[model samples]
Structure formats: C-alpha cells, structure tokens
Target: MTSNTEVFPVLETKRLVLREITKKDANSILDYLSDAEVMKYYGLDPFNSLDNALDEIAWYQSIYSNKTGIRWGITLKEQGVVIGSCGFHNTVSQHSRTEIGFELSKGQWGKGIAAEAVEAIINYGFKHMHLQRIEALIEPPNLSSQRLVEKIGFVREGLLRNYEFTRGKFDDLYMYSLLKQDLDKINSM
Candidate 1:
C-alpha cells in the first residue's frame, strides 16, 4: 500500500474524483473561487481574477511539496469539471491529527456532493494516513457546511471565539472532529 505521507493519492466516490489541484484546473475552479457568495465563509477574499486561482493552486502545490498538507480538486465524474476543492491542512503528524476544509461552487449546492467527497477523504485519513483524528474548523454562520460535517460523523467539540480574521473581520468558528475509533466502530457495524 502506498503511504499517504510519501505520495498524494487520488480519492474517489460514486460521482466525484478528488485529485491533485493543478494549474490546469485554475480556469475550472475559477468560477467558485471568485464568487463572493461561495467564498463568504472562507478565510480569504473572493478571487478577483484567474490569476488568483493560479496563485492558490501554486500554494497548494507548495504545501504538498513541503509535506505540510494535501489539497484535492473535487471533480465531477460526468462533467469532467472541477466543482470544488477539499483536503487536510494544518496537519500535525506527531499528534496524528489534521484539519479538513472544503469549498464548492454555488451551483453545486444542496446536491450531497460535498458529503461524498468528505467521506472519501476522511477514510483516506484514517485508513491510509493512519490519522487518529480529523478536525474541521468552520465559521459559525456556515450552516450548510456545519450540517455536512455533522452528517459525515464529525462531533462538534466547541466554538472558538474570534478564531481567525477573515473577509476583513475576526470570525467565530465551530470545531468539529472525527476519530479513528469512530470510523472503526462504524466499519464494524
């Protein structure tokens, strides 16, 4: 089995493919990244141009190269277009834990696509990366995402007040987590 630490792996679901985000995917991902509505809860402002997407892709590559984190472009299997991105960030190997983050185009909302992608990556984190815990820090106002994480089995730990500044303000975030034990329990069901 290939270790996730040594190589980035492509994860898949029935309708989606999570693969490395590349420069070629910039234009495809540009739609959502630049949409203020989509990026509302994100830590950064909406992209002003395709150049912003390119820069974001480069940043993703840099983190992977440094073995700091892995980000995947969430591609639709039928349409063959990237609709979003998701991945582990703020990874702490010694702690056997990492945080999850994701964003999807406004058009893709309410389709359960994010749930599928999150499930696949969560499995990869537990089974392939041997992570004991995976956490998600979400802006309190992102009800859709909070529901998504909860549906995927992440337990809400607590809220972090003024966690980080985003979109020109310090935002409160809810902390959610899933443990390896939780996955194992479900598998043994």
Candidate 2:
C-alpha cells in the first residue's frame, strides 16, 4: 500500500524491532548519525547536531505516518538500540516495483543482519503489500550490499546507466530483483 498510515508499524524479525520512526527518536537518529561508515551509504554526511537529527526523524515520521512509504527504525534486541534503518520505497510507476534500502552502524556489520532484514521485508512486500516485484538499486562500488542482495535471491538484472547521483555525480547502478512468482515458488517448496 502506498498509503503510509496503513503500514506505519511493520513486521519485525527475531533480532530487530522494526517500528515507525518518531520525533522522540532524536537520540536514536543521533546514534547512527555519528558514524561516517554507516552514513557513507546514506547519501548524506553524519549529522552535525542533534537538531539536524530531530528534523530528519520528523520528516521520516511525517512521510511514514501518511503511508506514502514504509520506513523502519531498526532496533537490536540485545542492546535495545536503534542501530540502523530499512524500508521499501515505491518507485517507477510503470514497472510496479519498489526499491529496498537499508543502513546499519559499523558495529552490526558481518552478522547477516542486512540479509535477514531484507528477507523479512521482501516477504512482507509480496504477502502483505501485494507487490509484484522487489528491486534493489545498489551503487556499483558497494560490494557488501551487492552480496547481501544476492544472498536473498535477488538476481543481477543489469547496470542502470547514470541512474543515480551520489557525492555530486551521476553513477551507474547494479540492479537486483526478486519476482513475486519466484518468491512464491521458493516459499512453497
């Protein structure tokens, strides 16, 4: 559903709490904002102040609360911390597909968390959201994200020429996709 109100709160996995972001989470946003490594893929530098984080959380909350998109604040069960965020962004109206995004703090790396989260969201997209296909537009240089998408059964569709602008320049993107029919086949087997 493109409406944000219907999906503000999303499904969570064993190790993560996927909840709608709120203005109260200024501190949580601040936590991930401090890490340049995590921010590297966020398309923006680390937050320079708490007020910037507050503004960001407010913006996310507004869009998510309206059901325009689905965004989750990823909290770890062990530490009860919001270490990252993930969600589905509807795009390319003619294709009827949505793009998946995720970012986690450096500390949470190498634990299969990204794949796990992607799996959960993918299932939700096909089952609950009734999406026909899911897509991931990963920058060509991000090896870790590329592998993570492949791990969850998304295939390399092709490189999208000058598809995205990052760090002030247009760049090619490696497209990955998982179709609903294929996902259903995997789930049924």
User: RMSD of each candidate?
Assistant: 3.0, 3.1
**Model 1: how far is 27 from its true place, Å?**
0.7
- Relative to the true structure, candidate 2 reaches a TM of 0.85
> What is candidate 1's local distance difference test score?
0.85
Best by TM-score: 1
Candidate 2, residues 37-98: lDDT per residue as tens digits? Answer: 87776677688888988877776665555544577778777666677778877644456678
For model 1, how does the per-residue alpha-carbon lDDT over 126-147 read when each residue is reduced to its tens digit?
Answer: 9988999999999878899999
Name the lDDT value of residue 103 in candidate 1: 90
Candidate 1 has a TM-score of: 0.92
- Backbone clashes in model 1, listed as residue pairs: none
